[model samples]
Target: MSNEAYAQQCNVRELMREDANSEVFFQKYTLSEETAARLESIREMLKDDIAQANPLWKVIAGENEEEVYSESETSNNDDESNHNESQMMHDQLVVPSTQFYFTQTERTFVETSDTSAALPQRCDILESACESLERNNGRLDFVQLENLSNEDLIPVVDEMAGKLSLKGIYNLCASMNNMTIEQKIKYLNVLCTHLLLPKIIELEEPSRLLSSAIVECVKNFPDEIQQFIFVPLLNAELKDTMLITTIINSFDLEKKAILLEEFLAYVKELKSWHISILQNFLSVRLDHNMTDKITKLFSGKALYYSKDKTFGKLILSFLKLNTALSQEQKNLMVEVVAVNETLFKRPMENILKNM
Candidate 1:
């Protein structure tokens, strides 16, 4: 009974946090009419963030281009549309509730009282809301097609990592083994951050469309991601992960520094970590005949590490590995880069020039 009352108070606090005088207050806190009236007196004490989204739906839906749904018209027609979503939609609602997440940008927006809060809100909320809609079999046909073209759908992948039960993500990872790079990216924007690591592990076939997409997407993640997600993933699977072709496919010289930072970080970890990842990275390099790109990308840096016993074979692999994959642009990438310099900017320009 005490737990139940505590839960009720929590709900009331959330509702009151948004706005106090609204009819939605009744929907949130159930009680005898007398108690409800007393609760109503304190409604104005709360802030607007606690307000339920339903009250604001029509206003936001007005932004929908298909037809203008005014606040009054929506309320009047509410009973007519069979698709009126359930009130429990709030439980499934993930975004717009800043209480739930603490992304760097969201933190900045909140602490500064910046109106630019709306900036990150669109990409961030839309992704979670879409997933919630998908799980409920909500009317999301338009969303599916709309997302098909949202190429940089990182939030989707990130949300999927967060929202899906482990069992669901397992199924998705299995099924995604057969998808294209584009499909994976579309699906990626829906994943959550925690799950991104395991999903990266699932991309084992370096040549598969999914693996290529994973490599392409993370190539630009913030520095921390390179340390945690990219480096650790490479460490975990460098030998077993089938990364040869995926890295080869990632031949965009412009992303090399971001790429190199990841590799260098891999080498700088505790000796135990370097021991694990370098073994795998070296094995893949040796087996795959990719000497030229490896040599060029590693340039002068190879000499420093070559003294390590494992280094000899990889260096030899460079001397003997085939150049079948080295086209003109890759050769140019090799020619210009300092042996170990990060290739951050020019890879893009080079890719564009090639195109």
Candidate 2:
């Protein structure tokens, strides 16, 4: 063979190796059925020519082409099997458990303003109330608990963390209409600062239950309490995205805009999975102005994590939503998609055509 022919053969072999091993090729770039079949046919036609021109053939398999072919076939099959196995393992590993879990700490004493003589009496009553709750398996004796003033109930609420399950808390809150709105907010604040936020974890189940109970209990409260309590909850260290998302769904469009405004500031640090959930939740009800704001925020940050598959998936979902997008927003999506065409091509094409 001429030097040019040998170099061309080497180039083809390197391209084939890249097709098999490049991460982008293996993951993001998928061949269509027809294209795959055509490539296979081309490979067969070149098999004899490749064996003849290849320099390593004699050193690797000298006059035993069938053995060489079989070994190559086995290696290709192993690559495919390993890829499938890894994909299955990934799917299994990421399946989050539905059980609620949280770390516990010893109860801290909350100060009360009772006189020294009355303090001991309050302590005895608090101890008895806690023991009663423990014996009753976290069920509230509303008649018993109702007789306690708000100051006395605060510590009891703090102690109910591991003792009282969400169902019990929901039931307790559901029966609290008799309390004035201010009193209810005061009580709910303890439930939040003492019970909910302290026990919150990064898992879904605990946050889901806690968020549901909170929304159910306060859904009928005055807007002032929701604004005061719910907005700050969005910034908790282990932020409960489920809670924020649920609150967004439960409120009116105006309330959602307010929540989303707060979310906009925090979303810069949100996990990609959390972003996906927010994408799904926001798709249903975001107004045009809020939608545009979100699009701009995500678009501005899109190119920074452009290679992240989860972030890319989020970009795709955002593009596919039925909400209105400005020309500038659409341009930003196009720019990010261009940066990662392997992952974003088909979806981006569909989005552009629709737009």
Candidate 3:
């Protein structure tokens, strides 16, 4: 054999010995049955080529050692290129199966559905609501009305107030401003009617919106309507202090005095808190002539100082506001202070000093 071929044969034997000893080398070049069969065919072809070239290489090496070295280097380059191409083909075949397995598994693992289905249109929703409102004669149940816009509720208020005589429209009035004064007066009239009187009387607490709407109606309409609305409220079995205060405060001095006189008859039945509200009403008064009536209203009565101190203070403060105090009023102040000296001490001193 030629020297170059002898060296190549020795190198191949060394590589096969290394592959036999190393598990990684063996695994790296291991092939499937089909690939192993194809490799065997290629090995046979290589063996034939080597066998044919051996004699020729020996002749060349004997003539020129440089030619043998060049030929051996060219053979090595070609073998390396063929090995890389085989590795690339093996990678291309193995990678696609791995990628396909993962892609199929991922598709099977996830759930998906079409999410672009249509929803009910806005106009359709409004039309349904309007039809429901009309069926109920524009007086929707409170639950039904809760989801409606204010504009949609306006017609409901008109229909309920005009036809059904329902006072629930007042609850909706806070969000509505399109209601006319006449419409509100009609609602207030319904509120004051004998039919609705029981509902108004049963209310343990007054609605502020309903009370304000009543006041608005009273202000915009005539005094007869005020009397018509207020008298029933005052007589209602469930008396709300805030509602009473609103009604009393809405009246002129003469009307307020008349109400005060009527309230005084029930003073014995009034709560301390109610008395405090009366004190607030009296405290804001600008009339001095009404002082004697207020003083006499509380005079000669065994009033509880702890409970009635606010009213006491209001009376003394009202008296002190006067430029001059009468001898009877001074005596009355002395009597009131004697009853609750501790509570009335500061206001009493101020009044005495002013006198």
* Best candidate according to lDDT: 2
TM-score, every prediction: 0.27, 0.50, 0.40
242-343, model 3: which lDDT tens digit per residue? 655666677777667666655554454434445555664563444444555455555554255534656666656655665365678667766666665456
lDDT tens digits by residue: candidate 2, 159-193: 66665555554554454434566556556556555
Error of 1 at 191 (Å): 2.5
| Stretches of candidate 2 exceeding 4 Å from the true structure | 1-115, 120-125, 132-172, 175-178, 201-212, 222-225, 237-244, 252-255, 265-268, 284-289, 303-310, 322-324, 340-344
Clashing pairs in 2: none
Name the top TM-score candidate: 2
Give lDDT tens digits, candidate 1, residues 1-355.
6999999999988877677667775577768999877766545433233323444433342334333335446756775563445544654575556555667667787778765443445455556554644452232222443433355345444555556543444344344344456654554434423465655555433335445434544454334344455555645544334443354335344444445445654443323223333334443433222344344444444445434444433433333333334465345434433232233334423443443
- For all candidates in order, the CA lDDT equals 0.45, 0.60, 0.55
lDDT of 1: 0.45
Worst 10 residues of 3 by lDDT: 111-120
Better of 1 and 2 by TM-score: 2
Of candidates 2 and 1, the better by lDDT: 2
Task: For candidate 3, list the clashing residue pairs, or say none.
Answer: none
Query: Could you tell me how far off, in angstroms, the CA of residue 290 lies in candidate 1 after the best superposition?
Result: 20
